[model samples]
Target: MTSGAPSDWYRWIPEQISARDYELLPEDFCRTIEVVDGHIVKCESPSRLHNRVARRIATHMEAGRKPEPCLMVDTDVDVRISDVPLSLRRPDVIVYRCLDDDAKLYAGDTVLVVEVVSPDSSFHTDTVEKKAAYAAAGIPVYLIVFLTEAADGIELIEEYRLSEGRYHLVCLHTRRLTVDSPIPVDIAFGDLASG
Candidate 1:
């Protein structure tokens, strides 16, 4: 199905799409939708401000990362979380600690996954479902950067750490925060995004 068609058509992949099928999808498919639970879910891109926030955080994380071999990459890459429903979720940014020269990486290599909350219904999925997915994937860190007005018109950063197959809220910051888990980094939302 193409983007022009209704989302229902992409909802569930009965036979599961192959790479060629994925390629047949419209050019905007990668930017607008992702497969989740064997269904295609639209992922509305956040505002330019959100992109700046994500980039800043990624840059800071890259600079502050310990000498470990991980690389902080701007997201938009597919990450397989499960096989039962053929779940594939793409985060806004990811810090992956690679074990070898292979390019594609999944939860095993993902040290941290971040999502900048958008204003649409995706907010629910981002906060609830995605959190659970990341935890179950055994990702060590998950960070949600809130920018939507319902978030009180103020920038909010919530960081969760995976523990015992669950995500525990480890810290919350309104302006700026520093994290030492999965990696060590200082994120100043005010200093970066606000500017």
Candidate 2:
């Protein structure tokens, strides 16, 4: 995990296995899996609340985008953390400049990436490591919607922007998030937990 590799969780799975190989595995009963640093990392299934929040944020973003430059889906893509690293990550949501239908979207084309902290999962992976990875890949904006163990359900939303090959905190809010870079966005965290 120091330089190029992560934890040895999948140490026995072999180092040369590709993403295709991970896909061919006989199905994981519970977890969502991805190949990171040539290791198969299993992510815990997101709780219904977690998914609901993510969906609301996505919906809100779609509703709030404006007319200057049409921010399209740019196609859902598996982003490589870096050109040399073998990380293929699927962010919860991503948006960028609208391009041809057939164009393949890469990290360089990303304008924003959102990650919602899952209630049933360890939120560690979404913090520094993934944010660093995304920043390292030159993605402009990164947002993390925190859904922690709090009485109100939604905890806080943290926004980070890439600056000088690294990410720096722009703002943190508990009720709402408004971002104006890479594409404007206004989201209400309270709406996410409401039925």
Per-candidate local distance difference test:
0.73, 0.69
In terms of lDDT, which candidate is strongest? Answer: 1
Question: What TM-score does candidate 2 reach?
Answer: 0.77
User: What pairs collide in candidate 2?
Assistant: none
Per-residue lDDT tens digits for candidate 2, residues 1-195, read 223343453453566566544444444311365556766566666777777777776777787778668776421245555333356677777887776766645777778998887745657788867887788789988888888666446889888888999889989976777777656667666667766
Residue-level lDDT for 52 in candidate 1: 76
Residue 140's lDDT within candidate 2 is: 85
Residue 94, candidate 1: Cα error in Å is 0.3
TM-score of each model, in listed order = 0.79, 0.77
If candidate 1 were superposed on the true structure by all CA atoms, what would the RMSD be? 4.7
